[model samples]
Target: MAWKVELTETARKQLTRLDKTQAQRITKYLRRVMMLEDPRDAGKALTGNLRTYWRYRVGDYRVICEIRDAELVIVAVEIGHRSEVYG
Candidate 1:
């Protein structure tokens, strides 16, 4: 079953801060991968304090998300450059 993808308000704002092309790429990747396939299979699970989240790479950008399998929802929590995303 296809999953529903939702972006948090903060994530939406973060995407606006990115370059147009980069934002588009990230959005496309999220739709194609996160929505169509099992999100856990599309990205690596995050470790340490952020263990609850998953990370999907789109070039230099990182898409941080939380997957809810029971609800079939993939919520994008944050989106930013790799260097700043984790911080």
Candidate 2:
């Protein structure tokens, strides 16, 4: 089944800080890759305290998401550069 993806308010704000091209790239990745039968196939599971979230790499940026399997939803919690995203 195809999973649904939703961006949190914070994620949307973070995305707006990026350039138009980068923003489009992240959104495209979400629609094309994250909306598949299994979003996990497209992203790696975060380690440590973030183990509950999944991380998708898009160039220098990282999209952190929470996968709710029961609801078939992927909630985009945070979006930022890789270096600072995990902090």
Candidate 3:
């Protein structure tokens, strides 16, 4: 099965603020997620929230998103440095 990826406004803003390395990291992580890797196999989210789940070590950044629509899509709401990813 295949799914569609959507970038939220927060994520779009975060992308512009990242350095080259950070951007690359985010891209790589997004690819893995696009391919639909099992969440359990992924690393910790650093800070676990009610609506957001984290997929850590997305290259060098953290991917903070929510699983919705029966897990057929991802709302990549935020991407940022590990320290800034949560909270």
Report the Cα lDDT for residue 57, model 1. 91
lDDT of predicted model 2: 0.92
Over 4 Å off, model 3: 37-40, 43-52, 69-71
Encode model 1's per-residue lDDT on 6-87: one tens digit a residue.
9999999999988899888988898887556677877999999999999999998899999998999989999998999999
Give TM-scores for every candidate, taking all chains together and pairing residue i with residue i.
0.94, 0.94, 0.72
> Which regions of candidate 2 deviate over 4 angstroms?
none
Report model 2's TM-score to 2 decimal places: 0.94
lDDT of every model, 2 decimals: 0.89, 0.92, 0.67
User: How well is each residue in 1-87 modelled by candidate 2, as lDDT tens digits?
Assistant: 777889999999999999999999999999986558888999999889999999999999999999999999999999999998888
* Residue 70 shift from truth in candidate 2, angstroms: 0.8
Model 1 regions more than 4 Å off: none
- Candidate 2 lowest-lDDT run of ten: 31-40
Best by lDDT: 2
Write model 3 residue lDDT over 1-87, tens digit each, in one string.
555567799898888788987787777766676676554355454342443464546655776766664867766777887777666
Worst 10 residues of 1 by lDDT: 33-42
